[model samples]
Target: MNLFTKYLHSVTLSLSKGIQKIACLLLLSIPLFTQAEDGYKLWLRYDKITDKAQQSYYAPRLKTVYADLSDPSVKVAADELQLAVKSLLGFTPVVKAAGTGSQGLTLTIDPKTEGINEEGFSVSTTPKGIHIKARSGAGVLYGVFNLLKNIQTGADPNVTSSPEIQRRLLNHWDNHNGTIERGYAGMSLWKWYELPERIDPRYIDYARANASIGINGTVLNNVNASARFLTHEYLGKVKALADAFRPYGIRVYLSVNFAAPRILGKLKDADPLNPEVQKWWADKTKEIYDLIPDFGGYLVKANSEGEPGPMDYGRTHADGANMLAAAVKPYNGIIMWRAFVYAPDPKGDRFKAAYEEFKPFDGKFADNVILQVKNGPIDFMPREPVSPLFSAMEKTPVSLEFQVTQEYLGWATHWVYLAPMFEEVLKTDTHVKGSGSTLSGILKGDTFGYKMTAMAGVANTGSDRNWTGHPMTQANWYTLGRLAWDTRLTSESIADEWIRQTLTRNNAAVETIRKSMMKTREIYVNYTSPFGLHHVMGEGHHFGPEPWLDKAARPDWTAVYYHRVDSTGIGFNRTATGSNALAQYPGGLVEVYQDEATCPEPFLLWFHHVRWDRPMKSGLSFWNDFVKHFYEGARQVQDLQAEWQSVKAQVPPEIFNNVEARLQTQYKEAVWWRDACVLYFQTHSKMPVPAPYKAPERTLEEVKKLVDIYHIR
Candidate 1:
């Protein structure tokens, strides 16, 4: 029997036990449903569908489930769905182990008996109820999850819905030491210590959640990869995790340590141009694929932040990417070469670095290589202008990399919803291929008709009881997958969908949460670092504001470097007089961003620094407008807080309490941010408070003292 057969057998056995457990408890009460439970199952609540019409319509028609019940996990999916339906809808279907036997709800294998692909699944409505079809049992599992999702979304599950994107992936920046960089939840999910010896049940649920979101790929290790994972020992451990994810349409990827030839193979130089180095990589690539045939290839972060790469050999990014591309080409895998590289060796404007580097190598990449660029230039800042590189690289197949983890956006402390921020960047016109140019259009390859496109979210998940530390933060992960599948999706639409599913089905509660979520990012930008004021956070941890310091080794490392706050004015000067960074644009984007009058108010401070007395195009002086925005942004959060309070009764107190507590945190931090920023800048601007606005309660020295106190100074 193949892998699917074994999985099906395991599922059959698990079902028999669950059914037996239910039979014995037939006289007992409804699911001794515990008050406290680990949120390992994610949003697949599997709650009993209490609606009589839904139960009646779905229960009987979903009677006899069918799939090529060969795989144990596929069988588990079949059994689990059957069990959930039986328990919730009060009806259980007699499942056909295999084949489309003249029956109700046939989730049959497409070819009936043959090899099946990992990531494809199709669901159709049978006259009975549903027919989940796929080439592989894992695909069947994906179909089951899709079917369940429709039911949860209040949509009729007895319909067809397929994914628009071929690849939906999660790039886990997890380290080998099990430390996830910028991870807010807890420890890494891959317990490398217990891995090859023991498999955790949470692994199944991890795959299940991704499958639900149509996510089909995961890069296992951190991009700052360690050489140990490339060894045979770790490959075995990876194989086990790969085995678990394989059943849910997810193919495992690794962040390959670039210096492997030198570190692992004892080579003198790890140059991409060297034949000996090339041979070693090809052999290593073959070794990895041999261990896990369905591996999804590599993610490299070379020549950035001190990581070694083809740049060391004096070659371009194409040389590095194509070298790896050549290594994995035989296996039909692709290389995701990150476009995050910058000469951190200088204090020069880091915002201008990516565009300077990658624009030179526009059409130099291999067909299978996708250059993954961040949504913004300087990490994931709160109010950053959409990355100029998004519009600059016309000939490259680019995948916009977005951070789902709240690394800089309040880490796990603040409730900052991110869909609106994503919408702003995706919808931004780069003008790379003329006026209608957008980040989405660039990714779709219409500008130059590139080979491929992808969007990856740095996963926020960890070993926390609630997947993300903040309960409502799951919306970030959900929003990413939704948008990746359809870039045209509106932030409000994604927020509403997530609110309905994650928070409540109640329209009032949904609307209230949606309203808060849509404005959450902007509100955050307003009170925290409004109007293109980027990188104002404390160094390394980036938890709080610290724009005054300038002691960092590199200019880019200091928030003061990006903000360029001076007695004259504030904000980085990327125009002709300063960095002349505007020349990077292909067309009139330079014109659009050059003058503060034409620049969008949100990004005005990002591109150009003006004096406190300089009148804004809005007719208000710079100082007056800046303070007004901070105050206005704070008031919006207050508005959101009041809106949430009104619909408190619609949601469960357990969930509501979690969010209410966070909003309280958000409100407090908003005040802290507003006070700290306005007070600090006022010292430089020497401006009085704009009339009708409140002055700071504490001094700038006071805020700095609080930060110093937190650092245990």
Candidate 2:
């Protein structure tokens, strides 16, 4: 018999009969060779390297590992490296404690490191092995993950990196009742019914995934929060999750109800200025910090969308936020007050609501309060201008909030990569200081010299076997974490890295997939809301085409309210003549956008209404150009399908099948969007469909009927 089989047989023979059965069952549970590709491992999947040259190169370097295990975070890092080495190099490394080794990796926590921040890490290589030095245990953990990523991508290991933002977080809009608002992946990850007593193994896996990508914080509940989360019963459950995640360096945060004083304490009225109300919040915050010592703090979505806030008591948002900030200050916690507020204005621009509301009270907030603003002015539309608040708020620290969930990008069914969108917004010159002052620079605190900086993504993860329903959507989650850690990373580079680690390492297949992924966001934009058309989806579901939607409970929620399509032309006049939202931008951008000819074509419809017969840069009229983009977008989906087929042999069968099926749905929906929008807008423009492309097979009326069916409960 082979040596492994002989050893196993002898070991089993030594065990008692019951112990032998248990050992056999344990052995059977773990595959002796390889695990199935079910996508649960995410980007950390350390599959055995099939490339002989790479194996030969990495095997020697991972012969031994030495790391200080005094810190729990560093212990997890050592364990992770050991696991990865065994899976990738085919043998477990000799793990030594608190000492240097002759070969393999060495992780050290050096508080006196010259350039590394608390959460940053530096990796250097020598003939003996690689060394990862960091200022904190969290940094060592981050360094370990980065080193593994470099090995997986076949990149150089000698690199020094730090997170540009102070806090990188994921805001989970998961309700207490196990429902996730706009979560398309599946049910909520937190099993509220069985927490504190029974800790699900999935919680550890979730923490591992987040830590691998450098996400340090997570908000546990929806921004439309329930006060029960602050109750003693729920605090115990939250404390249990915090304990499980602490080893991975992830701090748990909570989304709090602003009126918890009145709702839970049975106070007569909840007012920020009231001493009784302030004391209630102080007591609640103390109770929370006591349970979870490292609690990240609270995310407040108040005075917006009918939620209770100090505004209800005729007090300002600052009055409310500062009170909470003071309550958490003793525990070193910060308050993330959301600036996603908008009043029901039939004539006003929804894009200007947030800026106007918060800009006036810029310097009034407490030191620990961070005004969280969405990437765009309006809700997370497929395409939107960077919010004016990024430039307007000069005194208070502001954090960029991006929606990693595909709420407005066809939910989870459509294949849309959002890294490009995030990159575009980050790189756009806000002109806050001068010509080179980009949003990324502002967010990094380089341009503004702000006290704190952060980036929060509305999380898309759920309880699906694959965290995100669409297997490819996991890239969005990875992109957010990487960008949050370092805003300077290009979307192209992130896509390439993710494709190599998660999908395929084959160079040709990686390139094919990368190219396809890079084009998906723009392709989705073209078919759905090209040329800066925002909020055109169906009312509640936000799925199919709804460019024709003229009625809703609120005017701002309707598609026509923003588009402003008329017999003369189509587009919102945000310049001086209309909402004057352009004036809110810096003088340079205002001048650029005020004129129809100078404005970028992508935002042409967003800023000014132009004649349908106006000549476009492509030498085609506006209407003809619009029709071309619609057709081209639909055509691109077909091209993506063909490209995906080319890489079938490289991707796993389950992943390939999942993506292939999603592509079919995306293609069908793209066609529906193209046909429905072109036909519906034609009614206003009084123009026929441009030549070279035939009309849709289905009529506008027929398309409307289909959309109605989608809106059904």
The candidate that achieves the highest TM-score relative to the unseen native structure: 2
Candidate 1 structure quality by residue, lDDT tens digits, 122-238: 666655656776766656666687677676556756434444455678999888788899898999988999988889988887877777777888999899989899998999999
Candidate 1 Cα deviation (angstroms), residue 175 = 1.6
- Would you list the clashing residue pairs of candidate 2? none
Per-candidate TM-scores read 0.89, 0.95
- Compose the digit string of candidate 2's lDDT tens values, residues 436-548: 78999888888778988999999999999999999999999999999999888898899988988888899999999999999999999889887777788888777788898
Candidate 2 matches the true fold with a TM-score of 0.95
For candidate 2, give the lDDT of residue 421: 95
lDDT of 2 at 547: 90
lDDT of 1: 0.78
> In model 2, how large is the Cα lDDT of residue 277?
95
